[model samples]
Target: MNGLPMVVSEPGLPAKVTIHEVGPRDGLQNESGIVAAADKAEFVRRLADAGLTTIEVTSFVPPAWVPQLADAEEVFAAVRDDPAVSPALNLPVLVPNMRGLDRALGLGAQQVAVFASATETFAQRNLNRSLDAALEMFEPVVRHASEDGAWTRGYLSMCFGDPWEGPVDPAKVVDVGVRLLETGCWQLSLGDTIGVATPGQVGALIGAFERAGVGVDKLAVHFHDTYGQALANTLAALRLGVTTVDASAGGLGGCPYAKSATGNLATEDLVWMLTGLGIDTGVDLGRLVATSTWMADRLGRPSPSRTVRALAGASAGEKQ
Candidate 1:
């Protein structure tokens, strides 16, 4: 119940950081077993109560593609109707194409995102289209969504490396990113799909985006802890003025389509580091740990987040 880290704010980093929580959607989408829409709605309510302002609630893709989220409409409707879940909460959902967008907007979804790939192999594998073709596909989708005034984000996966195609070119990543931004996406989230990027590569990619005239205000970083570099890369991006970072509770959620994509940067772990650095994320650490623990029990597993495990265990010892 205490903020342990002394306020040692780094000079270059922002005073406040926005964590885009994706556990509900990204984390559960990979689950083979069905998580009931009721449980999913409760999870979203718990996250909002724990002070996560922006939670990716669910996806609008076909049930055939992500059967786990087949009840997206039900889940969204439940949360949208729940009195406890704040109306101001940003509940963005993933939409694969125009049809998906139509479905999402039909249910009164406001914030939506389109997923893209930095590598051709991943584009073909994930989207069943070439990299440029996928970007082209997103153009009209993004335009249509923007015309409706939906806050759209473009998620460019494999920004660092791909399993089928290794060592992604930063220029290539920037090209796709620029095209997506030009298509009127409000933000671009560069994903380290395989979690292989180090600090230098993270800085270089952001720098390349800068060279292409894209600033940090329009950028966010989505890193996986597969190689234990997520935090480090996040730090690098923070120093480069990236204010928004994507994370999942309990270190959950890899890509359902990309087997190589491992666990996302845990929200608890990211909060711990940000707290240590004197950065404000507006998350209650104690409640956040408990919320993750609650979800972990529901999932029949322990949370993978080092912070959640440590803090939860410490609190348990205190109770004893």
Candidate 2:
């Protein structure tokens, strides 16, 4: 079977797009078992090797909160060991609070992200605080990062739908998003936490942000394939001129806090679609497929990414 991705340029979508790879941190954090620091480092290295420049390596949340990333220090050190890693790589770590930010910055992390929830229910459940309280929590973190002159990103989860809240109000989501941007976030990634969003919902949310004066340039989309709407929603985001997309390599992870949140949109799948659209992601598809295949082997399971399975064949070891 042919593995080369066919190109077909579409109108509106940019000629080039930036992919934020979340497999290492967001992906692995949801695994039922803990992945060793060495393997996690290898995973980050392989992704960088595959030409994913923007990679979220690990989170600085307390180990008590996320045992999966208990070795955050070791993992960060191992990945940064390569002299060639930084100037060419964009490694961002998630910081849950002031302590998390302090730990990451202490290790010389140049880029950090703050995660928030659009809904009060999810905010309380995932963050153990109210929606307003969560933002109050991030204020200091973002401020400290700015003072330190490190790049900062803000992740707004449940932008589309929330498990406990049912369908979320697009306007409410807009308010939350604008608030996050006002908090000094360099970029805001809108998430479809439970994967219940369709392309229309995605477009409406983006339009809401646009109306609120949050241009597409400062926006990113993070989708999950739970309802198989990830690709469709991503296409909508691209058509609307939103360039940055968050995807997981080999469809590796979901929300550890949101139990219903399934795996993220796979990096391989996003790359294949972008390549077919004639959009430059600067990623080598074959190498990316191989990297996912290798990661799946180490994780002791088959990848859920169709592109990986199709390109790598039985080496993918995918289950139905």
Candidate 3:
């Protein structure tokens, strides 16, 4: 993708966008190899220096479940002492339950996250529980976090489609999302975990949330790049005034349920598109690309971000 058109034709678009960098948690969790804690801390510092307002530093999930994030406490401690990092910024950690939430609080995390699925099959497969069971488990955790004065964000995955079960019901998504909001979650991020959502699907989901009396101010989006529809879906969300977006550096994670699903929309690609559309993300594209390259090097693979490839190509030509 070449990114958003530079022509100033579109008259009405949001003035700013919030890129919630999830590389340390979501991105690294899905990697096949383990990333050192010190390297992860450096990555967080670099992303912060590059001006990413919300960087998901790590997850508080059990080490047996996600071995990659076993060093969550270490990573959290490392970033907490960095005086130059964003003062009021959030370093959200994915907390699966009260135990994970407790671990997050023990690490002095100001924000934590919980995730569920719209489909029962996905919920069971991913979280090893029925849909209702998952909600029940998250209820107390959300309530505890709320009472403690920490921000909690809930993620509803497979909002558009599921691998085991085809198209998911938008009403189900809205139901779970509303429940999450009711549980005192500060934000509910609807995730296209399989990247199967189109712009119309995005509009339908947003419409359902609207009709259910859920405020768009607390709505965010997390779209995968499986079918290359993430950017389009993001545009649709932006049109509906959704500002917060979850993205991974280097497009590092794919849905575990979908074999063909690629990864979360690249942070560089998202920032590039948003910048071209006159949406300020407060992220330095050059620095973001460099950070992606660093992680890609560690993984011994090239990044999948089109913007990164194009920028690298252009820089090479200039040097030549």
Candidate 4:
């Protein structure tokens, strides 16, 4: 303790971590009731105001397939006109096929995402095809988007474990990740679809990617909190220099394939941990918690964030 400055010993983690909020797309997709277009726009606006830089605004799949997102075009239109959410930040839409991509491009989206699974069983259930066929189907979409200079993110679901297939091979994940990169996607998000990955497993999978010559900077992590391992696993990825993390506000998401699976890592929970560890997530914790509260109210449920619950309890006590 002699003579060393306190600031030198307690320096913050890195100054930047990109938070790709998937509340609007991933969160609402699995919801039973459809969220109104206006409500959805307001939700995104509130998140943006709370300092989320990159938001996954919507998906362009057909209405029949996902009735929850039937108002995709309307929601995109609303956000496009919103002064709070501007072009300075990004609003990446998930497009399942060329038609979805066309709709997204028409709405002036500068960024888009495509979805694929690492294992055959999940792929069949999700995309109704083999792994190779699903990847081949996105070729034209990726090619066109790249020509237009739009950034694309490819989601590789069940990178560590698949509910149907049990455990996923690390090399299989690498093959899909490489194919996506070769198709010109700027980033690939490896998902823990069932939320069963431990920190050690996360490190091993990330190490596999490193050995395959995949730059850590081009990777993102989407973790489910089913078993309460999301944040711990996230810390592991951060330690490996993977900066981007995908989270859903209000902890809203679950995999239909895994019955016991919980939501994506709560945005509020992740922000709290990052800020405490001196990591910069560019997200305001209090406002994010407020937004989650609002959504929980709308859905008639309590918030799932442990940090939010603790803060709320303290606030109530102070008020009393």
Candidate 5:
């Protein structure tokens, strides 16, 4: 498979893409059942073994806000102590505000992510603050995280369309993204929170960011597969030289703020496409499938990832 002919869809597709695995944090936060800290630790270890270098391990938000991740400290400690997990693995935890940052810092977190919204309505609903106020809230978090020498990521949600606002302008999205970058965020992840973006909208948004002097190197994409356009939109971003892509294992997350939003792009599905394109991700598709399948059993449901389903089905057939 390594010797396969390199296939470039466009003139300058990225030689490799970075997959930011967000399953343990973004994926599990939306889950109805609270996963045990030990289980979450095992999940992260499995992802690390599967070659997911950067995994969002957990969120430092208050338990009242996200009970599923209430055991953030325990989960982080467990994974940190596991000798089997690579020491080089980047485990980023979500830190919503100063309090969250304090908690993550106490845990000796090496990386953290702050989330904001592209539209005013979503901002008010998710963060309970206005657009400007939400950005202000993250300013200190990003600054302190940077000062502490921790890698910081800024997430801008509802970049394409908001449920209340309908269609979003690409210029507005770029402006919000630039603000996040200016706030000391090392990287900005533009999110299709409601999964409303198409390839054309994605291309336009990335192009606008580039025109605004925000290089693709400082940008990543987080697409939800609500409309089955996550992979398609990702392809568009990759063609534009956006290398970092955020996905969940087993397609296991949704936006609690945006009710219509569904699961994220599955890591297995993304890996299949990247491998087919001869793009290096350093991920093992079979191990990823096994991890997701194990997680799905814990959730008491089948994985939403088509790649996982196909692979699992083939494995079952072989035994039969």
Candidate 6:
């Protein structure tokens, strides 16, 4: 389906937006039931078939830490050799540190991501290091990934508000973001890990980054849907000319570290809004909803995405 016309009243929005699909990795990582490597491979394949060019396939963190992605290498191998997979598809794996980066590189991963937190409590609890120390750990990882001819992405978690720390200062978020960029990260994804951000907070964060001399092009927004405001926050980002967005299929994942944090914004839901806004994403909404429905069945639950649920219900009614 084509995007709607841009003659409407939207302002400062990009003509096209890049939806970075993170279901296979971020979405599944929080699941209690472990999905087999082959199923994970099929999941990635299906997402690509649905025209998601950028999918985060897996993470190379230690198996003990995240057993859900224990078979990262196996999962990577399955997709990397698939003839049906697009050669130009970007399958970025999360590399927590040097060890994870080495594992990803060993598997011949072309892209990797490193994550840091804007809040000290989360940094200490999640990474087991102070914020500065965590960034220090990622610096070498990002540098080595770049040197290895692989693109690197940095994830700055708790950008808007942290569960432990009530409200986060946008300037501090920008400071952490700039450090990641200076460390050779090609792109930085600002994450609202606890999902407490409103549209005003989103705009303030983006504005701070822009004022700090960081281009919006180097930034992506990753919002959790816990507060039911992911779509609103995303629209705020889009209105400010930030094009890249990180989302999961079926709204599958949440921050395991943050007890209150919920699923990432669903890709299907995001696409529905973007298409209606006349923003080109090149994703087939029907196919995306179908893919999410299939995944929801695998997980033995209804999808968390409003668009997916509505579309599936309509399809069921039509069949009836």
Candidate that would win on TM-score: 1
Q: Once superposed on the true structure, which residue ranges of model 2 sit more than 4 Å away at CA?
A: 84-86, 314-320
Model 5 pairs in collision: none
* Model with the higher lDDT, candidate 2 or 3: 2
- lDDT tens digits, residue span 23-89, model 6: 9999999999999898899999999998899999999988888899999999999999999998899
Candidate 4 lDDT tens digits, 122-184: 888888899999999888899999888788899999898887788888999998989987888
lDDT minimum window of 10 residues, candidate 3 = 1-10
Global Cα RMSD, each model: 1.1, 2.3, 2.1, 3.8, 2.0, 1.9
lDDT of 2 at 195: 95
Q: For residues 72-135, what per-residue lDDT tens digits would candidate 5 score against the true structure?
A: 9999999988999888889999998999998999888989999999899999998889999999
lDDT of 2 at 100: 93
CA lDDT, candidate 4, residue 93: 97
Kindly report the root-mean-square deviation of model 5 from the true structure over all alpha carbons: 2.0
TM-score, one value per model = 0.98, 0.97, 0.95, 0.94, 0.97, 0.97
State the lDDT of candidate 3 residue by residue for 62-149, as single tens digits: 8888888899888899889877676677788899999999988987888999998889998898899999999999999998988888
lDDT of all the models against the reference?
0.92, 0.92, 0.86, 0.86, 0.91, 0.91
- Residue-level lDDT of model 2, residues 1-320, one tens digit each, is 35767677888889899999999999999988988898899888889988999999999999999999999999999898866565668999999999999999999899999999999999998899999999988888899999998888999999888888899999999999899888899999999988999999999999999999989999999999999999999999999999999999999899988999999999999999998999999999888999999989888988999998887884435433
Give the C-alpha lDDT of model 6.
0.91
The window of 10 residues in a row where model 5 has the poorest summed lDDT is 1-10
- Please provide, for model 1 over 63-143, each residue's C-alpha lDDT reduced to its tens digit, 9 standing for 90 to 100: 999899999999999999999988999999999999999999998889999999988999998899998899889989888
* TM-score (C-alpha, index-matched) for candidate 5: 0.97
Per-model tally of clashing residue pairs: 0, 0, 0, 0, 0, 0
Q: Give the clash count for model 2.
A: 0
